[model samples]
Structure formats: C-alpha cells, structure tokens
Target: MLSEQPYPVGTRVVVQGKRGPEVAKVRGEATVPEPQARYGAVLRAATPEDLTRWEDLHRQGEDLKWLLRARARERQLPVKLVAVEFTLDESLVTVSYSAEDRIELSSLIGELRKHTRARVNFAAIGPREQAQMIGTLGACGRENCSSTHLQDFAPVSIRMARDQQLPLNPEKLSGPCGRLLCCLQFEHTQYVDLLKDLPRKNAKVCHEGSGACGKVTKLHPLSGTVDVHTDQGMLLGIPASELKRLPDAPAPKPKRDQPEA
Candidate 1:
C-alpha cells in the first residue's frame, strides 16, 4: 500500500507512464480519501517487466530527437528543434524549437502526431529559453547562467550603466539575453552613495590672485585643493573655501565679418 495514494490491492499502477511492468500493491480499504485524490490511486505495484518497458520508452524518446532533426532537414526548415518530451501517460508530446520567426509547423506537427499516435504540441521559444533547453556555453565560455542556477532575473537599466561608470555601448554591456547584463547592477547602490559625497565638476574654487578667479580643472578631496585654470591658462591649486562656485559660462559670441582691405 502506498502511503500517499490509496490503491486497491492487486490494482495496476503506472509511474510517469514510462516506468514499466505495472507493480501490484495491497492496500486496506480504509485509506483516507483526500490523500488518494491528491496523489492519485496506485493502480498496481509495478512489476520488473514494467520497469524495463519504461526504460526502453525513455531511450526511444531520446532517439526520437535525432529522427526529428532528420525530418526537419528533409523538410528544409530553418528551425532547430531541441527537445521532445512526453507526458507520463504518453498521451501528449511537446516539441521545443527555436527560430527567427513564427515557423509554419502545422505539417511537422501533423506528421509527428500521425507517426506517434500521440497529441503533439509545438513550442516556439526565445533565444534565452532555447539556450536553457539546449544547454550551451555562453559568450564568456562559461555554462549558460539560465541553465545552471539563476532562478530569478533582475531588471538591468541604463542607470546601472551610469552608476558603474561604464560606457553606454549596447554591444559591450548586453548579455546572452540581449539585455543589459545582470551583474552591472550589483554594486550600483555603493557607487551612487559614494558619488553623493563628491563635488560637482564645474564648481569653481577661489584663486590666490585678487579679483581673478580660476575655473576648476580638477578636484582633490584628500589634498583639499581644487585644481583651477586661469583665463590665461595658468593651472593653480586653490583651497576649498577660496574656491567660489563658478556660474554656468555663457556661450561664445560669433565672430564678426572682417572688412575687406
């Protein structure tokens, strides 16, 4: 008697429909009804013969993948069908494929259904899911993140690029998913927090000369000197208080036309 599901004594049971030789198990008639409903009644204890048949079916499903590939080639289809999975009862079969567009798979599905005598389902997955199903190496030469252990995907944004001080080049930052890499957002909070303590780049520091203020060239937080350049292009180090914030500079005036000599 199975503890989860109540099965009548001498009833036939199938496990995953592929485990062969139906095993027979004896159960008392007084088993709880809810557990039986949830786990399903064991039809019978699986026999050794049933186990062998299940293993054979599993192998046949594996071999069917190559057959499907050959069929795709014969049909001249530009799709890569990666996985063929069958339900436990062998009543349904799902084929997973990846292609650039919505492929016309009605004929392929019809052929599979006709040959296998099982309900066929065609799943057109995106590149990420295809990579997951096929299990491939990524651009980094590492096992794909999706197939391994990344259960949750975080949203990667342009703010992450700005915070990480990375360039805004899509080719450099995008991942196998064709979106910004998840790793870029990891330390963004720390960078943003650190940036809050820094002064603006265009801030002007006080210069030593009377009535002549130098424009800020660079900032030195540790040295407390703001590097400044004068109108004549002389570079000087000025203390923080001596540095006065410079107003936004006006745009340059257009040159007047020269009189003909």
Candidate 2:
C-alpha cells in the first residue's frame, strides 16, 4: 500500500483491507516512485483509538481461537487451527485452519456463531500457507522465505532437485512446510541452461585431459562437472568443459515430458 505521507517502517496506519478499513503496520517503501496497478493508498496514520481497538480485537481473536479449538475437540474434528482474524469493526471473524482430509464445517460454523456476534467464517488453508502463517526458521537457519518477503509461493518440484543434481532424500529436500524447498526454484533456470549442452547420464564421453573414455554417471550443474565410470573400471570427476561426446555415442534422447504444475 502507498501512503500519502511518508512513514517509517513499523508505523501503524489505516488501509483498506480485504474485509474493510483496518490498521496495518508499514514494512517497507519503494526507493523509486514506481507506478503499481494494485497499490492501495493508506487512508491515514492510526490514531490512539484505532490502536486500542486493534489491540482489543487481537485479544478477542486469541480467545476466539481457543474457543474454536475446544469446540473442534469436542466434535472430534481433525482441523488444525491456523489463525482467527476479526474485522476492525468486529462485524466479521475469519477463522483459518488446515486439515489433511475434506471436512464438513457447516455444523461447526453454526455452533461457533452462537458465541460471537460477528458473522463467523471458516477458511481452509494449505500446508504451505499454514507454515507461512505460523512462521518458523527454515533449514537455512533464517526465517522461512514464505513467511518473510515472498508474497507468493512459486511452484517447486522433484524435477528441480534432479536438474540441480541434488540428492533425492525427502528430509533434505522438503522445507518446514513439508513441501519441496522454495529455494529449489531459485537457480533452476540457470542450472537448466548450463546442463543443456552437457551429455546426459549413461552417454559415452571422452575426458580430454586423460584421453579416457567413460560412461557419464552424474552431473554437477553448478560446478559444471560430470562423474564418469571409465571403461577401465575407474571413476573420475571431470569438468564438462573438458569432455566431449564420443562419435559412437547413441543419439541424445528426446526431452522428457513435464508433468502439469
């Protein structure tokens, strides 16, 4: 959101939120005054009254979360609560949750409505969104990118790991969200470009440095290296730049079909 008056980061200001006008904290500003299509202007700095109301609503949201959990437990539902948000005017309450399987929440919503004057709304969120909302440190030791600056999660895949010559271990590959790390998509295009000219696995190639013929075994995309199992039964790690495909090597295979995103 853009503010009419410049405000430092952490300043509380009122802005139009999805539900209605609400108080939000400033996180950053553009150094350049770039035009943006979706920018919403900040109405004004939050007054003391607005801050007080926001704080009260936050406490109420916490209580509502507790009540929601208790109710779900009583009904034996598998919902894992994520967050509860009340509109600034307390006209609506949005409850977000995650579940492994589909659940019928009509009865649950009806029961929750009795405890609050605001209209009750239940929102379903995925594992990735849940992690973003909960916030946690990633394997990198920094805060999870999804929870920090990433506005949207990019599509990550096992193929990305494979292209980058990463181990296929699930524990090493999965992030806190239990999904493939978002970092996998970061350098995937560069890896793909670098590997495009390299010989595929199992192809016959000659190491120029040693004049030894070998079968390509593995690729290290970032380092531009290939692992080879020589015909002499010796293993060698040679730079792709130092190797050439053998004349007798079979024709390169067609590109594998990609799965839908």
Best by TM-score: 2
Give each model's whole-structure lDDT.
Answer: 0.63, 0.83
TM-score against truth, every candidate = 0.49, 0.78
Q: Which regions of candidate 1 fall more than 4 Å away from where they truly are?
A: 1-61, 87-92, 114-119, 137-142, 152-159, 167-179, 186-261
What value does the lDDT take at residue 144 in candidate 2?
90
Cα deviation at 33, candidate 1, in Å, is 32
lDDT of 1 by residue, 130-189 (tens): 666567666688876666544345566898776555668988787776766656766777
Could you give me the TM-score of model 1 versus the true structure? 0.49
Give per-residue CA lDDT, model 2, range 86-162, as digits (tens): 87888888889989889977766775677678888788988889888789899989999887656567789899999
Clashing pairs in 2: none
